[model samples]
Target: MGRELLRIEHLHKEFEGKTVLDDLSLTLREGEVAVIVGPSGCGKSTLLRCVNALEPVQGGSIFLDGEEIHADPRKLPQLRQKVGMVFQSYELFPHKSILDNITLAPRMVQKRGREDAEAEALALLERVGLADRAKDYPRQLSGGQKQRVAIVRSLIMHPALMLFDEVTAALDPEMVREVLDVLLDLAKQGRTMLIVTHEMQFARAVADRILFLDDGGIVEEGRPLDFFDHPKTERAQRFLNTFTFETVKE
Candidate 1:
């Protein structure tokens, strides 16, 4: 663990007056991977959106590397540069090439030179094993490939923290492993990541700590082995029982 890279305090969120998250608080260290897991509608995705400042919080604060995150239009562009997010849907532009999709933000938002941005983009693509797909369009790629590209797009920005929100949820069973493998590789490289996932086996393999959310707050948290083998809370136990837990080979 390194310095605290992300901190959420007394976080609260609501949708149409219904509370989604209530008084949720957590901190993520610079090189730690914390996996959030729970049953559906547990506010797992909402929490990630709050941390990224994509959703408005009714109360509480989120600090990224000591700077508070707000939806202030003037500051959000820069703030987002430090926090890269990958969604369940691969939000790549259908018309642009993979390299273009990856390099677009760096070129336009960060104002880097084309050569510099493309060079870095190519390097990141190679890292994700998509070097050949640089010229390919999103529509040409499989769900898994597009998702990997999405991951590469985020990585090229060199974010201090990475957020994954059910990134494999939209993929077929056969496609899920390829995307998960890329994430496992990233975890091995010591990336600070907050992941919302239902893949129990993958969560167990990659998480340094597991946060079990329920009823709009963290119900239980522990190391992977401890959380999986011996859940302290009945909520967590019931949640685990819903999944046929299996060992995921690293």
Candidate 2:
């Protein structure tokens, strides 16, 4: 029930004349984990990118902490720092060691001293259970480990909000949980997150609110349990039916 940390009104985005987002609107509050779920090409990732201003929207406003991000280049870097993002590809710097990958941003962007940045990075690496692998290159770590490192990299900036763009999508079944576990831990600590994911159990378990998108518009949204189990819209019900199968076996 805190003040809204993020507010999007009448959002729209198009790519080469094809509509990707259509009058989409959403809001998020401090410490809220809002998960956006939809089939491929449904603009889930685009929505996340727009929130952080990684992509420009043709229409509407994205308000981060009551400041507009879209259409304003001056605020881009600051907005990005306030809103950290973890992509599915991990996007780690291959040439840098894990420690460098984590520390580089805080040092370069935030301009913290090298010693301070390295200390923060080491602490984050240990928090993510990757302290022992700090010296390793991206290629040396498994997919899950790399994503974990990416998470730590984002954390070093101390973002007010985190956007996860399918961080576990590239991992094998056994590897997905490790990344998810870290995300869950962050959620437990009340880190605000906006996740674009295909992981239904995760959406159900962690999201404070759920948004279901299709054909460039939000078809439905509500509390995760109601949205997943008793969707009010027929489209949402059908979408959930397809995604909610394969019960997680213990």
Candidate 3:
């Protein structure tokens, strides 16, 4: 029920000759956490990418904080600063030390002083329980550790909205929780986020809204309790039934 921070209106996208997003419209409010769930090739990831102008929209428009994103591609740099994304791949710089990888964007793009950026990165590292590994290179850390660092790197920028694209899909079972814990903490802090993930338990525990997409359109969307316990659409019911888990966290 917070102020609207993002609005996707009649959005459309295509790859080659295929339509990936079909006149999709959704709104995200400040301090809201929206979890996107859909079957493979459903365009969940494409929606997030287009929100930040990472992908071009073939039709319709997206507005972030009331500003039209596709209005001018020239303003993308400024528009992108308010959004941050972490992908399934760790995407950490191989040669750079962990701290350097975290600080690189702030130092180059934001033109932040190295001292200030490092200090902030260190503080964020501590928050994620990885302060001790600040100077270590990406290859030296475990998969979970690298993902945690990636989240911290994004958090350091204090983005208005965070986009996560199947971040835990590449990790082993044990490593998944470590990364999810960081995200849970962020949710508790009331950060506005739009996440595309298959982690059903996390979706139930943290999301204020759950959006179920199918065939490039939203099949259903509502509060967690409503959508999870009583999905209106058959497609959503089928999707949930396939991902059965033990004792969903309250």
Question: Per-candidate TM vs. native?
Answer: 0.96, 0.95, 0.95
lDDT of 2 by residue, 153-216 (tens): 9998999999999999999999999999999999999999999999999889989999889999
The positional error of residue 15 in candidate 1, measured at the CA in angstroms, is 0.7
lDDT value for model 1: 0.93
Candidate 2 local Cα displacement, residue 232, angstroms:
1.1
For each candidate in turn, give its C-alpha RMSD to the true structure in angstroms: 3.5, 2.6, 3.3
**Model 2 Cα shift for residue 58 (angstroms):** 0.9
TM-score of candidate 3 on Cα atoms, chains taken together: 0.95
Model 1, range 133-235, lDDT digits (tens) per residue? 8988999999999999999999988999999999999999999999999999999999999999999999999999999999899999999999999999888
Higher-lDDT candidate of 1 and 3: 1
Please list all clashing residue pairs in model 3, or write none if there are none: none
In model 1, which regions exceed 4 Å deviation?
245-250
